[model samples]
Target chain A: MNKNRLTERKILVTGGGAGIGQECVSKCLSEGATVAVLDRKLDKLEKNLEKDVSINSTVLVEVDISVGEQVCRGVKQAAQELGGLDGVVNSAGIDLVSEFDDMNWDDWSKVLDVNLTGAIHVCQQALPYLRLNRSSSIVNIASGAGLVPIQNRVAYCASKAGLIMASKSLAMDLASSDIRVNAVCPGAVDTDLFRQNIRDESDIEQVKSRYAMNRLGEVSEIADVVIFLLSDEASLITGSALAVDGGRVFH
Target chain B: MAGEFFIEFEQFVMKQRKVALVTGCANGIGRASALSLARSGMDLVLVDIEQEGLDVLRKNVIDLGSRSAVICGDCQDEHILDEVFEFAQRDFGAIDVLVNNLGRSAREHASSFLDSSPDTWSAVLDISLMTTLRVTHRAAPSMKRRGWGRIINMSSDTALIGDEGLADYAAAKSGLLGFTRVLARELGSYGITVNAICPGAIKTRAHDHLKPSILEKIKSTIPMNRVGEPEEVAGLVSFLSGDGASYITGQALAINGGRYML
Candidate 1:
């Protein structure tokens, strides 16, 4: 409820063009943080920010985070443009749903590359700059599939679970540097990516009924958690995997 | 910008004077949480076995300009839990936050699992786990009707890491985690978030009995190389009990100075 909680803080949000990433970008700007958005789709990023006056202060970088070289250069460029970096939200992720037996090596590797390695690239590049600031943080956007197995999502689940453990290991390694790392595991958010999975109106209703809340989560709900973990309010929280599901896995 | 969302959230919370009922408010994490919640603009209902401690905290809450109610009774007593909840609903109208901070690992009773008596197990479990079960059972219905509540249970890192001579304590605390997860699932639709906070080696009255050398040995094990303050744990409890943590449910957050990572 506090405005300007992240005042003067400069943060880079990956996948900032759409879905939960877009919500994080907007929320960060509203909380008074200078933002740099990295996404493969530069046009989508531009279109999302075009209506806001804060666009003047934002740094937009076209980057495919799955590529190591691009992430390294993009992070450096964003840092230079923003003067420095205080935190990062690795919200860029890709999920490919296929049965384990049917999935090819390329499909499995691609999901791991974008969802897990992409986050690693961002953290690796941002760590040096993040270490310079006090109370710096990194928030990785994992998913409920990471904590519990989801049918037909072997690659997605494996990558997210790995990402969650990676976050904990990084948190332990960076604790001495005052850099906190945490993960958010969201379940069934109503995003374009999520909508793409549903075939019909009845499918949507069926998915909604799986959760105890009898509804899907909004992107902003997950973004709210990202902002909180990045703020000074969560100084003591690190190596924690917070589930933002509407109680979908309880049953 | 999404500034309007936060403003609306602030207004929604400010529209009513929220009430928080905390157990084991005599000292340590409980006392710190009680004070923190009071400062966050919530009226307080403090429960503890020590009458003097409750009186002291009651005065502290009143000084913060928030209403205070004190119940001097053991949390393990079912009748005491019933009275506490009745008093809360009669006075506060609806319960908004519940902090189950009424558990401890007694040094005298802690021993090798094979040598420990049944009495020790019952005492430890009754105090740490059953008390949580008793109080949460009574407070949940009111919270469901209101459509918003925050329940924080205090667990220990011992349960996570499996320390020697703390088998019963670990079992009880571990049971709390299971309870927290199931309750979070059942209550998620009702707008009530259930979470457990696992703290490691915090400086509390419980630690006053330990020798300095033993404390130093404990500190060396932590990555931070220092024991945590009670306020650090309190800060987390306050954050979890606020509107910002609405999306976080069924989480077990550890504030243990990098001692354990899960």
Candidate 2:
């Protein structure tokens, strides 16, 4: 990967504290983008950074994208700090693990508010700067649950599905502005969320046996996708929901 | 072939010799596709129920001088799939290509859908249609991120032209074509191209099991008047996965030697 590809470009990624979001931040930095990391947990961001350092650097901001005021201020600060904005990656969102019938209004609202509405808020706040840039893009981190129905996470599925459609609509609206919009639907990635799920399962081996490919995916795996969607190499790509789920959804 | 198309594809494939995870590699078409892709220097994650066959494939892919991991398991099992992907990434790095080449049917169940049990139909769909969906869903994210990914799904000519006795198999493969088109539309923007390949009858144990009279009748329908080779179908799979077909998405390219066209 060329360090100059994203050189001098200002990129903002939400939920940058952990998992897929963290990987995106690191990848953007590696591609030479001046990245702004946004997350609710400042400590997690600091701790996550202790892992590996990219040749390209980033500025970390503690703000929740789900909150409108926080989102606006965060975008403004990131834009100011980085000089200007070239792209926004809406990778910050919550994952609730519960069935629809067993869930309450709060669960549904929480999932939608964070996953779907939070993405809208980020885009809404970032659009002004995004529209002004000659080259800009928005990459949303959706899930395979959004594309294919997952068994126990109804709210998560609905929110992700909405995000997919929302990304498409946004792509169409921003196509002329040269700001591409896209979403990545990751299938069971090997993150903390997956580890927790695995711990909860009685027979972990049996659970892993479901996919034809025979395993879960890595966070870096999903991050590599986000980088591509946000890069100039994908100049013609827009209004798409790509899946990164091993072979889980194939059948 | 268009000059620009070939150039673009060659550049794409060489620039990122993306790894591929292929299902149903025990024998038949899946094994052939895997070997062809390996020959092209793409690392492979080969899956199958027959451990012996998979071991042989691993050796062959290694002989091609490309990295390969053999996964012996049933495609219907989700856990096995997760491992296959993990192995692919752990050994070969990111997956840039995915080939869904698994096909199977019970001896008696191969007769007619109306006579087959619900379990038989479900099994057929799981292997043919669902397997395609699952594997592509898994491999696409990184491909999308890398801004270049290729998905070559294997559908059967029977699916397009239809087969009275093999209703379950036909329906499953037909459904796979539909899945391929929709996925092509959905994943086009993230730099991922999705397409399906429909192969005609080839010489394999699975085909050999079919009644001789029916097999002869099938060959007569072919304008080429001969059975197709697994390698021939594999060639198309390789082409589609390579850069030569970058602009070609939402397409179901047929490789049945004029036996069927759609």
Q: Which candidate number would show the highest lDDT if scored against the true structure? A: 1
Q: Per-residue lDDT of B1-262 in model 1, one digit per residue for the tens?
A: 5999999986676558889989998899899999999998899889999998888899999999888778999888888877887788777776789999999775766779999999889889999999999888888898899788999999988889998899889999999999988998889889988888999998998788889999999987776666888888887888888877776778787888778875
lDDT agreement of model 2 with the native: 0.76
Query: Which 10 residues in a row give candidate 2 chain A its minimum summed lDDT?
Result: A242-251
Per-model tally of clashing residue pairs = 0, 40
**Which lDDT tens digits does candidate 1 get at residues A22-74?**
99999999999999989988687688688999999999999998999999999
Which candidate leads the pack in TM-score? 1
Task: Return the TM-score for each candidate structure.
Answer: 0.91, 0.54
The DockQ assigned to candidate 1 is 0.44
Candidate 1 TM-score for chain A? 0.97
TM-score of chain B of each: 0.93, 0.90
Q: What lDDT tens digits, residue by residue, belong to model 2 across residues B121-226?
A: 8887777788777777778878877777888888877887886777888888888888887777667666676777777778877777778898889878764455
| Candidate 2 structure quality by residue, lDDT tens digits, A78-184 | 88888888888998888788766778888789889889999888898899889788869899998878877867888888999999889877876776677778887
RMSD of each: 4.6, 15.6
